[model samples]
Target: MGTKESDGVDPRVLRTRRDVVDAATELFVTEGWSVVTHAEVARRAGYSKATVYAHWPTRLDLMRASIGKICDEADHPEPTGDLRADLVRGLVDFAEDLAGGHLDRVLGGLLERSGSDPVVDELRRRLYEAGTRSLEGVLRSHLPEVDVEPSLALLVGGVLTRGAFQGRPATEEFVADLVDRVLASTGRGEEG
Candidate 1:
């Protein structure tokens, strides 16, 4: 059975939505949230403005779709069942994303415009959940229930601060040291 026919939706409609959302995500990530107008997304996706508007009625709609796409496409390292190793790998990948400038732009855009709109706040929450899913899982598995969130914050915040704020690379040594420090502080310490 043809899935589109089965679902009673046209394949063309699906393609248009996918194209438009991809374009919107690309624009939002590369140029920040301010540039993700319907007109721009329409232009980038090679769709008519009216077509874009027909699908997403407002700028926030476009932004919400774009943010959803970003979260859907987030890539994180696979966990190896080793808490420290998993965290290091995840943080290293995150650092690379930050260093590549895409994640930072997305985060900066969301943070800059956050708190003014509930939708934007939800988008920020979604992004955070998607971004931290892996590390959060590792932390939950290895740490006390009460310490999970704070430890997650400390680890991710350290990486974000080092890479984004301090403009320094989250090198392996730095990340390993960070993991050791957090683990020690949490009383998990390093495993032999």
Candidate 2:
């Protein structure tokens, strides 16, 4: 195990850390990260504050680790040649929580913690880069006829984020409409 490996951090430490993150995700989704305390997370995880501290020295670390887990769960845009389908799949995955106001709440709490926490921006950048690559792959596949800029992958991501902002939930029907729009815009429609 390398220094970066979680396994190297002691089995007890890893378990305790995972517990904190799991508890924080559950609590943050409901109580919002702003109000969630280490003590609360520790209690929920059936651990002590000192144990939580043993893994996460500060609240930001706990928040970032938890968000990182969520972001990892959201990694999508499976490498199907049909970018339209891939984008739709990714959107559905990313926007489900958005439409239900989960994304807004999650981002709101994260942004508050990140305002002064340097780790937030760094972690967010990493997550954004990862998500952007997934979207770009889909867009290039769907828009092969057009010049696709990888940087513009954000457009596809934004569409879903915008849906979340527009108060749309990740419903099968709404996802279908989004898929239609994405396919049509990307020249994946029948005409294309």
Candidate 3:
């Protein structure tokens, strides 16, 4: 048989979920998110809206899952301890992700909903955490004693809102230079 859904969803649930998200991403890129509806996503994915919503309860759920899927597909390499080099690589990856445009749409839609929707707010926090973990780990390695937790929010949050709001592309060189400023501002000596 195929996947079944109950108290716990099945593995094929994941596949079906991917179909829905792929459909959503394509629609967001091609038609703009405000114009895309659950019915449109269902048609694109060749599934019922009930099937889509069974796996993704809300638009926020679908958006978060789409971003997570994109990140997974990117399969970005982990940083290898060189602060500047790692930051440049990570920022390029992020810029590529952002410039793909679906992510920007997803972020924008969710942000609007999140102003009054607690579920959207939590979904955004989870998405941000997922995207920032590798960068945060690398930053802490470079400045172990620095309160880098706040930096996690600042760096990624700033990049997303600023880039999206300003319609500015995030360049690797820009981020690399920003890394230098961060190191200097932190007054950190050699982390080795």
Candidate 4:
């Protein structure tokens, strides 16, 4: 059985929609979400304004689609049973992703605009919650019964504080050490 969203929509249509969404995301990340107008997206996507409007009736609709694409493009790490190794691996991958200029820009924009715009605020909240879910998955696999909220704060706070505030590169060694400390704090380390 073919679904309307999957098999019914033509490949060309999907490609064009992706192009437009990508263009909008780039604009939002680079120039701030306020700059993502239908005209600009159409121009960047090589589509007519009418075509953009046909796909997305409103600017907010386009913005929501772009945000969805951004979230969809993010890496979601899966736990591999070895807590320390998985944490280290996942954190290293996260550090690399955060090091990208596009992600950095998008995160910065989300933070800066979160307070003023309800949509951005919701997006920011959802993004952080998504990250927490991944971290909790790792912890749950190792801990018999654990409260993961504090651990979530620790892991996310450590990364952001180290990279964004301290202006330090999240080297693999640093990430590994951080994961070790977290495991130790939660009584999951070798000595525990």
Q: Pick the candidate with the highest lDDT.
A: 1
Off by over 4 Å in 3: 1-15, 29-32, 53-61, 71-74, 166-168, 189-192
lDDT of 3 by residue, 1-192 (tens): 122322376668667776888998777655665766778889989999888877777776666666556555544577877876776677667767777745666566666777687766876676666666788878888778878876656556556665677777777666665566666667742432
- Candidate of highest TM-score: 1
Per-model clash counts, in order, read 0, 2, 0, 0
Residue range 69-136, candidate 2, lDDT tens digits? 77666645447666555656666666665556366567666566565756777766665665566766
Model 1 lDDT per residue over 1-192, tens place: 124432867779989988998999999989988999989999999999999999999999998888877787788767788888898899998999888848999999889988999988999999999999989988887774555888888889999999999988999899999999988988888572
Residue pairs with backbone atoms closer than 3 Å in model 2 (clashes):
99-168, 99-169
Error of 4 at 71 (Å): 2.2
Ranked candidates (lDDT, high to low): 1, 4, 3, 2
What is the lDDT of every predicted structure here?
A: 0.87, 0.67, 0.68, 0.76
- Using all chains and alpha carbons, the TM-scores for the candidates as numbered come to 0.93, 0.73, 0.75, 0.82
- Give the higher-TM-score candidate: 1 or 4: 1
> Candidate 2 — which residues are off by over 4 angstroms?
1-4, 75-77, 113-115, 141-162, 169-192
Greater lDDT among 1 and 2 belongs to 1
| Tens digits of lDDT, candidate 4, 88-168 | 777776676666545566677678777787987888876666555666687777774987777767776777778877888
Which pairs of residues collide in model 1? none
> What C-alpha lDDT, on a 0 to 100 scale, does residue 124 get in candidate 3?
64
